[model samples]
Target: MSKVSAFLRKKPLIASLMILLLVLTAGCSGSNNASQNTGKNQVVKGGTFVYGRPAPVTSFDEYSEITSNNAFAIDKVFEPLVAFNKDGKIGNWLAKSHSISKDGLTYTFVLRDGLKFSNGTDVTAKDAAFSIQQHLIDKGPLAISAQVASIKAKDNKTLVITLKEPYTPFLSELANFSNGILPNNFGGVSEKQFFKKPIGTGPFVVQKWDPAGDLTFVKNKYYWQKGKPYIDKLVYKLIEDDSQAINQLKAGEVNAIESLPLENANELKQNAGTGVLTSGSWSIEQLFFNTLDKHFSDVHVRRALALAIDRPALTKALTFGYAEPANSLLPPAILYNTNKTIKALNFDTNAAKKELAKSAYPHGFSTNLLIASGNSTTAHLAQILQQAGKTIGININIESIELASFRDRFFAYNFSTMINGGQADYPDADSILAFQTDPKGFSKSYWTHYTNNNVTKLLYEGQKTPDGPARAKIYANLQQILADEVPYIPLYYPDVLIGVRSSVKGLVVLPNGSVRFDSVQITK
Candidate 1:
């Protein structure tokens, strides 16, 4: 699972109980019209908005660490040529306009005139081309760099990108926050110096950073967007404990917070001074099997375990009815997930037993299930699997460890099976699928270490095909193949929940789970 998911999954019951109390208090106060009240307020500037994050940002550099925890902060300092709006549609941001060739292999972008970085340096087409080439050289967390054959600056205002093949979701891939443009001389800077003093063409500039504590930003005077970033200052307070963050929100110490405990989210919806914003994200929590493990080597054993879990019940229990059961790795919000006919592996213990009987160990086998410690939801999931395993004659041993230890074992390919969370960097299926199935270029991010020739071929073909019925068919077949193979069992997709003070207007939670504060204003 992604670090954000793990952070949010902690202290669910306590958060729920706290929310119940807050809801009762809100009921006795007055009518609930936080949304209407917010709309009635006028946009005012010159206030510091304090936001809360459950964890500290691992790195300031976008290419070094692109986790959701740091995305909102990074976006304030850097911008992609194209970006996803609040509605999840791709729109021009730094670029004035863009076009794709008829062959679908070449993409051209025209830079807006007089763009300047936070450091007062000119941002030209050369910076765009250099940023992409730097990502390719560094082989960052994102997989989009793998498809680029070449990137060249036609002139000061024009940039061209040539792909190895026709990639239909190329535009969406560029919209990813990880693909944010950097300064031309960024490659020559040392990592430590860059983190301490980062430069970008974004709305805000880093004023102060307290390790493992908080990050403060001041408005960028050279920001290209005129009169934007109405808020003069943005503060991200790092509080690893969810309960403390919720308390801070209630006390008005913070203006906004995300990944609230489900129960707290429920109660905050009725609170007059608070507004709860919920939106679907591309994040998916799933069980990934290590194909290198002996027990999971057999398809029958893998399929049996997949069929044994009741996804609908698990989803309801974990999310408190706020999230829907995920049938595939790609959520329905993405463009490639157009196929609705493919059936998910249903819950059937009898069928599970029968499938296990076909495996080498007809009597079933024992294996360790790795999960992160401090996550109540994952602990509950592990217990559910343990009980269900007994019915199918399979034995499961749950091993819960700290997040650091879990990552160590997971990326080293030392686990049998693990329940984790992952989010597509963009809306494209290739963003996630390529890393999972690409045998030749799989990074440490692909913890499952799954390798299948057929799956790899399908992923490659899907990337080469343009967007249409043919491309949809390729992805449809690919999902079916992975479903049958049982490399990663789809669990559920959680809703992105944000709690904001009613006075905070125009705060939008993007589908990718990043907060857009360009139009946000704090009303008195």
Candidate 2:
């Protein structure tokens, strides 16, 4: 078989069936507005910009949210104090301007005049402070809350945030989903009831939501940005299948679709009335090992696994020329990612076998890889690992778990091994380094129960130092250490490809997997 064909090929029968289904029902189930799309340059107001989002939303509580996709939906209804622009630089969003104290421990923000929530009540420093406090109470993104000492609403427009120490990522962390401003105390409703119908100072208001169906949002007339959100309504229609979503894009049933399958990206980019927004996203598709397990406890075994797969070849075969193999824990797009600077553990079958012989499980050991089902790319990865594991005398069992349960198990650190991926919340190296490398991080340092004094020290060193050559040196050393230890194997860095209609304008597909929708307008 040819190289590309071999890697892309899977269970032929199932793959054939899925392809058949895509062909048979491509545009048949599109929304009522399904029709031929025609491109135009003029911006038209009062039109609905329907977005095709995969999977129904199960949660909208930003304070305790787990995944970026969940945050994507909630973000539409809640604007941040500040947000990263296309360049990953922090820019003022809700806060008109801000300044930091000389010691860098305190920050003062002045709210934009006439700011109001979806309910028309004015947005004040109190609301922002209350939102930050709520995030801390809910234990959202520990790195963020752990640094914040206190938040004070000095006046309706001025807010002061004091940190226990000078945390460099504090501003970027505030712009993340976990710190989005909401109504003070959830608008006087129970926590459960409030998130059920959340209100925020965002571009759109939640009109209705169905966990198993579509989520509709109407233009928030009270939205801080004047004459903005030109679309009369924004709808996140649940279309789980990539082919079907692409079909809807062509048929003009959906203005945009998230997570466009890489296989079809080139085709969609070439197709008329359709354009694909793709970038070298700041993320990685990788395997997380549970070092507590006897089989994985040995560094030799972990390194063996890393050397077995040809990351470059796999990425090339899978991404359709859209991305490069991840040479470091951070993707190449991230600043100071160390992709080219530090060489990765390249494919070495003989070296892998030698490393396995050094481990106690030289005769081989069996382990189960728990992965969430429904993702074809992940399933394919499991198969490749299963095959590679055999060469090293390891017996691999692939466990396909449902998405929701998989998350529950992962966060609890209840697994032998798992395949997972995510984009950094912010653009900086510290954004991911703090959470994925710090021992007390969100993922418990890549969910392996892995810990290292050197990594821990470098993580904090990188966080405390401001971004520059000095800070970059700290992260480079950190990456080198993690690479040698092989706590989590660096894998492919796939580009985030979003399917957009030709007429869709002002939509920003951020490399961090969150799109900016406030300025998104459908030009008809």
Candidate 3:
């Protein structure tokens, strides 16, 4: 079956019809509109929006954030030059207007007048230029920065950037959390000092932050957007348990639950008025391997694990029929992503055993699966993998570590196997696809150290190639190459779920699973 046909088969009859209707009227948000109160008087703002956070957030260094929890929290206190709206359209945030040269080599942006950081510091073009340059300096972590040749502040109000080549994803790259603009030269302070208590041209200012507990944010009086961030304060309380999160949502304790699992969607929707909001995203939950590890060094072992996973069954177990099994590294929703039936090494325990038998460890070996602590979803994923590995005589040990240590270990390439998931910084495929497959890509910057020459060439080709069928063909080829190589086992591309109180209005969750709070209002 094709991607769409398979997707419909996985969902309920009602949901399948809804999906067909969605395809007919494509741009409609697949959210609970009646509960969100779209037509309600959203202008009545002034309540504190207490959002429940599912994991620990220790860092505020926007450009170096390791976890989505940290990124989502800090996003309120930092502003990006440009961002993708819910509709996948790029919109100006800090820039009033922008223009690209005819050759597409040079780009100029005019800063919005009267822009100021949370601390009331003037947000100048120099600050914007410095921020972009700083991100570029951290070259390995930022794939998009490689496209830039030079960044200069033409004037206090004008910022110009010269690109090494004509790249399509530059604007979307700016939307990445790690690319948020920082104060000029770290506000005349050391990088550590500035990040300790960061200030930016966002709608909120960090008031108090407890990495293991909760975070409080006050409305930014100096925010460039006038009379915005409807809520006066935002308290992000850390809740690790899924049950507790749902209880809190229903008890009227918190207005939002970040990263709510789909299994609890119905309970929340039935009990709490309009408690769930879901958006299609490019996010993929996958299991990665350290290619150099003793057990995974052999290609046969890696490919064995890929075929061992029952993706259809795993998707149902993980999302409770809320998500479709991911057919490729990129979700079918993304541009240039193909839904054609692939010759994937799908679930076949017998084939998996045969491949494992060919490896150096013919009898299977023991390895630890690293996941962030307090994430029930990943914990469950670990359990499922543990059982599945057992079927093939592999002993899977799960190690749940805190966010801080997880980051350290991940970047250090210390683990044998790990459960990881993420979407592109923006909607474009290269924002993540190349970052994970190409040698100059994922292995260089991310956890997966897998490399292929063909993947790298295709990635570079896809970047310079303009938006058309030609680019799509290049990306499609790249996907096939990665699938065959098995750098990672793509589990499923999940829908971004948020359990929200019906009273919360004007909240915007982007397709990449990030939320915008500038317009969020809490109603009683």
The candidate maximizing TM-score is 2
Worst 10 residues of 1 by lDDT: 11-20
For candidate 2, give the lDDT of residue 180. 80
lDDT of 2 by residue, 108-137 (tens): 999999999888898999999998888777
lDDT of 3 by residue, 1-524 (tens): 00110110000000001111111000111222222233754365566778887665677876555356676766777777876677666678788888888777888889898988877788888898999888767653443544788999999999999998898767666766667787888988998889888888888888988878898999898888887776778889988777888777777777788778777877776763545777776567778888878787688888888878898898888787668887687766677665456568789999999988999998988889888776677788899988889888889999998755775686689998888775665657776676676666424524567878888888888878877789878988888877787888888877767888776667776666667888876554
Q: After superposition on all CA atoms, what RMSD does each candidate show versus the true structure?
A: 6.1, 7.6, 6.7
Candidate 3 stretches with Cα past 4 Å from truth are: 1-42, 401-404, 440-445
The TM-score ranking, best first, is 2, 1, 3
Q: How many steric clashes between backbone atoms does each model show?
A: 3, 0, 0
Candidate 1, pairs of clashing residues: 1-420, 1-421, 2-421
Distance (Å) between predicted and true CA of 104, model 3? Answer: 1.9
Tens digits of per-residue lDDT, candidate 1, 1-524, equal: 12225521110000001011110111111122122233666446667878888666656666655456666677788899998665566778899999989888889999988899888889999999988787677765554544788899999989999988777668877887667887886846875687578888888899998756788989888989887788788889986566787778777888888667665676677666776767766566778788888888788998998889998888887788667788776666666663256776789988898999999988987889998765456778888878877788889999998765776687689899888766655556676666556766534326566777777788888877766688778888888888888788888877667877777767777655677877777766
Relative to the unseen true structure, what is the C-alpha lDDT of residue 22 in candidate 3, on a scale of 0 to 100?
12
Q: List the residue pairs that clash in candidate 3.
A: none
Off by over 4 Å in 1: 1-41, 146-149
* Candidate 1 vs 3: which has more lDDT: 1
